[model samples]
Target: MAQQERGKRSRRSILEAAARVFDERGYDAASTNEILARTGLTRGSLYHHFPSKQAIALALVEAHGEALRPPERPVRLQSVIDLTLEFARRLQSDPLLRASVRLTIEQSSFDCPPRTTYDQSFEAILALLQEADRHQEVLPGVDVQEAASTIVGSFTGLQTMSQAYSGRADLLERIGIFWKLLLPGIATPGLIGHLRTTLPDD
Candidate 1:
């Protein structure tokens, strides 16, 4: 147990350091030496856990997503709003995610397929869309594929906006406004009223 705990701590430290470096430099520009220096770990130690900068980046993507899994499922419209905002918060707060998202866009501009790092993220988002459908929360006339695409695009836009103002109050402030602006248009009149009354701050 002690050995496992130590290993976990070591990996977390390495990932955190790597994330910081990746955020400061971009995915392609980041150097393993910077990660090692930031992590205070030896070269061999970093290599033992992550074979290369790309490997560390892939791990960062997985770790960033796994770290945000909430305990309870979102069952209501308000819950979905909270879930989205919470996701936005994590994306802005986690350097690894910020870097990976940027990488996803950059790679796409070349007409390249999404890397595994982004594939995982896309799958998670698809699950969120499926959930909204399962709950009948999506407004009528909202096509699943189209809605998914739009939401994913919106999410990407939000991430870029947040990265531009990292650590600023406006990021979350704008995200909240985004959900509020979207909700009323999609939700049924009664549901919209409920959401407005229940979440005035939203």
Candidate 2:
């Protein structure tokens, strides 16, 4: 049991160290040595957890999905809004998520075919929008799937721009503006007035 726990810790350390390197240098320029230097772990330890730098990058990209999982809310539309706001907020502090976003945009660096990170994000939002639809929270005539795609695409642009402009210092505020403009189109008129665009008080 102790060995298993240690292995988990070691893997986490490798991943986090790699995330820092990837976030700073991007996938093509980041090196295993840099990740090792960051973690102070030997090559063998890293290989035990990840076979190659691409493997580490892939792992980070996959972990991005975990960050997007929002807690359930009585108002599903609000859940979607909160999820976006929270993700924007996390980008300011979470190296893992920032690295994942970088890796996703630099998909050309990957050896595999183009990834489905966008599709994954779209699916998550689509599920919430579907729930909102069933609850009559979505505006009539709004296609939930299209709305989901738009949300994902818009967020991708928003975060990229936020990162470039202010290192995402203003991301939460940008997301608030985003929802203010977008919600009225997709949310039921009654629900639109109630949706919180800003992050809820911590």
Q: Which candidate ranks first by TM-score, i.e. highest?
A: 2
lDDT against the true structure, per candidate, is 0.64, 0.88
Candidate 1 C-alpha lDDT tens digits along 1-202: 9988877888888888887877776676778888888888888878878888778777766565563453254445565555556666666566666655555565422232345444554555556656766788767776656654565567668766765676534566676677677776666556665552122343
Off by over 4 Å in 2: 112-115
Q: Which RMSD does model 2 reach against the true structure? A: 1.3
**Candidate 2: tens digits of C-alpha lDDT, residues 87-160:** 88888999999998888877556653365578778988999999989999988899998899989999999999
Global CA lDDT of candidate 2, please? 0.88
- What does the lDDT read for residue 178 in candidate 1? 74
Candidate 1 residue pairs in clash (backbone atoms < 3 Å): none
